[model samples]
Target: MLNRNNLYFIRRKVTNHIMLSLTFLSVVLTVLPLLLIFYYTVTKGLTSLNLDFFIAMPKPVGEAGGGMANAIVGTLILIGIGGAIGLPVGIMSGTYLAEFGNNKFGNVVRFLADVLSGIPSIVVGVVAYTIVVLPMHHFSAFAGGVSLAILMIPTITRTTEEMIRLVPHSYREAGLALGIPKWKTSLVIILRSAWKGIATGVLLAFARAAGETAPLLFTALGNRFWSTKIFQPIASLTVYIYDYAKSPFTEWNDQAWTASLILIALISLISLLFKFLTRSKY
Candidate 1:
């Protein structure tokens, strides 16, 4: 057998080596792509970045000056509507899964949720087109919002359930011991404790929904004019970027790059907010 001193030295050396390797790998895997994306976007998109891009409406194809204000507004409206439609339903479903669900029914619901999460965004757009756009006789922002809501729901439900599950069982026991109703305990005590996690999930869902282009393609129909009406077809930032990027015009391409940069910034901000919200205070 090795001497105690030698054994200790060997173990320490092995552990330090392993930790160094893991740290290096983690840095490479996570930081490299983010740095590259940021560098590329800032370099290319900064040229077209201006206040007018955020304030003015899109002009005709050959027009000298224009902006994506309409698309920006429409994106916000669609995301807001989607959040309104999905948030409560997802939270309720998650509450059921974490608190009340069991056995076969819960399993089936979970499977369906996972399946929905995996479905392609384009397929969702197709379904929305058939059900809402076709039946209504026109594409509208509402239909696009509904499609995004469908995509958001599964993500929120899964995250909420996981967050609720992470709450300590001791809390539940204490609530029960106090003779609190089970529903009240679950909603009030458990959910409150898990609020940060739920908020993180909601923000993540919003980020994902905001970036989706396929669902809005057929439903919103990509307008160039400012549209405040929920019942009217509208343009969104994602669709605008996608369409403009493919155009031959240099100006349109520049706008696309700028819009993409803005979208990336928004997603990064949301992610940072989630991290801030979830960071331990102590």
Candidate 2:
């Protein structure tokens, strides 16, 4: 005996509840895989976690009691090299695209960036090998870094452009109205405002680069011992994980899980640190 209006209202309420439930379910589904991976990694890795694992070199085959100190340092070094080459280029390219890219050349650059982003990481590794390793006549950390930088550039460039574009046009007008030069305004007001987003994008690129193993396989070639020279092969957590995971030894298998845990932890720590450091004061 409900009125038509009451029936319509009931239907609307039911629809809203159903949609909300659906969205909640979707979120749960999206997060479940990540949670499962983390749980399994933590459970398997904790047994192998020790001070030695951070301080000692990899043990010889069929032996025990070793660490990944060299791999850890090498990973940091590679990241440094890649960031040095990639960050400035990406930020500058993105700034140009956002501010002055409403033309054919900009379109071409944007298109190229998109295409580069879609290219497989292994393909990029091969390209770097051909360009760097072949010329040098050996695999090197430098080659690995070059491949990582290439992968980083496209993501950082597009992210930078998008973050900058999100800034209000009024901000630009205000800076210009104050008699600030266009370049200075873009550098100071615009960039400062968009820095948090840009930093997040940079961190994302770093995380992706850190996780890449195939590129390093073709470039760095995975050293077993310590090596700091840029021109020499270097170790990395991902490579260690790859090698250990494929080994027949149980110790190596355990270490692989530990290395995976370490890689995930490292990326998470860096991301949190970057976010904290780049948080807006105002």
Candidate 1's residue-wise lDDT over 1-282, tens digit each?
999999999999999999999999998999999889889878888878889899998888788768889888888899999999999999989989999877789889999999999999999999999999999999899999999999999999999999999999999999999999999999999999988988888997899899999889989988878897999999899999899899999989988889989988878887897888788889
Q: Give the Å error, residue 276, model 1.
A: 5.1
- Model 2 C-alpha lDDT per residue in residues 1-282, reported as the tens digit of each score: 999999999999999999999999999999999999999999999879999999999999888889899999999988888999899999999999999898999999999999999899999999999999999999999999999999999999999999999999999999999999988998899999998899988999999999999999999988888899999999999999999999999999999999999999999999999989997688
What's the lDDT for all of these models? 0.91, 0.94
TM-score of 1: 0.88
RMSD of candidate 2 to the truth, in angstroms, is 1.9
Per-candidate count of clashing residue pairs (backbone under 3 Å): 0, 0
| lDDT, residue 1, candidate 1 | 92
Off by over 4 Å in 1: 1-26, 273-282
